[model samples]
Target: MESNQLPLRDIHLPEAIDWWPPALGWWLLAILIPLSIALMVWLYKRITRQTAIKAARKLLLQIKQDQQCDNSQKLKDLSALIRRVAISATTRNKCAGLTGQQWLEFLDQSVKGAPFTLGIGQLLANAPYQKSPPNEQDINQLTRLCEDWLNAQTKRKK
Candidate 1:
C-alpha cells in the first residue's frame, strides 16, 4: 500500500479527569471534617465543665476543712465558692448581681426544696452582714446544701 494511503490514525488520549466531581472518598471526607470538628468542640466543652465542677468541689472541701477560718470567714468563703461555681456553670446574667431574696430564689430553683429561700440556706445572704458567726450546726447544714448544688444533685431546670 502507498504510504499516503495507509489506513492508520494517530494515537488519541482520553479527556482529562474532571476536577469538579470528586471521588467518593473525597466527598466523604468533606462531609466528615465538619462533623469531626463539631464533635471535638462538644467534647471539649463537656470536659471543661466537668473539670470546673471538680476543681470547685475541691475548693469547697478545703474551705470546710479549714479550722483557722472562723464561722464568719467560712460563711464568706462558702458564699464566694457558690457564686464562682454558679458563674462558671452558667451565664453571668443568671447569677451575677443577685442579692438578698433574689439570690436565694435563684438557688432555690435548683435544689429539691426551696432550701435557700425557706431554710438554713438563707443565711448565705445574711451571714456576710452579721456581727457574729453562725452556729456550727447551721454552718454544717449550709455547707451540705452547697455540696449538693455543686454535685448537680439539684434538679436542672434547663
Candidate 2:
C-alpha cells in the first residue's frame, strides 16, 4: 500500500495540570507555616513574661532583705522597682507618666480590693519622702503588695 493510502491516527496527550487545587505537600506547607509562626510568637511572649516575673520577684526579695539601706531608701527602691515592672507588664506610656493616686490606681487594677489605692500599697505614693522611713511593718506590707502585684500581672493575659 502507498503511504498516503494507509489509515493513520494523530498523536494524543493528557490534559495539562491545573494549579488551583495544589498537591498535598503544598497544602500542608501553607497551613503549617502560619500556625508555626503564631505558636512561636505566643511562646516568646510567655517566656519573656515569666522571666520578667521571676526577676522582679527576686529583686523584690533582695530589696526586702538588704541590710545596707534603711526603710525609706528601701521604699524608694521598691517604688522604682514597681514602676519598672509595670512598664514591662504594660507599656511605657501607660506606666511611666502615672504618679500619686493615678499610679496607685494603675497598679491596683491587676489585683483585688484596690490595695494600691486603699491598703498598705498607698505607702508607695509618699512614704519615701517622709523624714521617717515607713515603719518596718509597713515596709513589709508594701513588699508583700508589690509581690502580689507582680504575681497578678503574670496571671493576666498577654
lDDT scores for all predictions? 0.84, 0.87
For the record, the alpha-carbon RMSD of candidate 1 to the native fold, in angstroms, is 2.6
Model 2, span 1-158: residue lDDT tens: 99888898788898999998999999999999999999998888778768888999999989988989988889989998889888776767887999899999988889988988989998989785677778889989889888888988878885
Give the CA lDDT, 0 to 100, for residue 37 in model 1: 100
Off by over 4 Å in 2: 1-16, 128-131
Candidate 1 TM-score versus the reference:
0.81
Q: Looking at candidate 1, what is the lDDT of residue 3?
A: 89
The prediction achieving the highest lDDT against the true structure is: 2
Q: Across residues 1-158, which tens digit of lDDT does each residue of candidate 1 receive?
A: 89899999999999999998899999999999999999998777666667778898899899889998888888988998888877767778988989999999988777788999989998999887877789888999999999988867223533
- Give the backbone clash total of model 2: 0
Clashing pairs in 2: none
Per model, state how many residue pairs clash.
0, 0
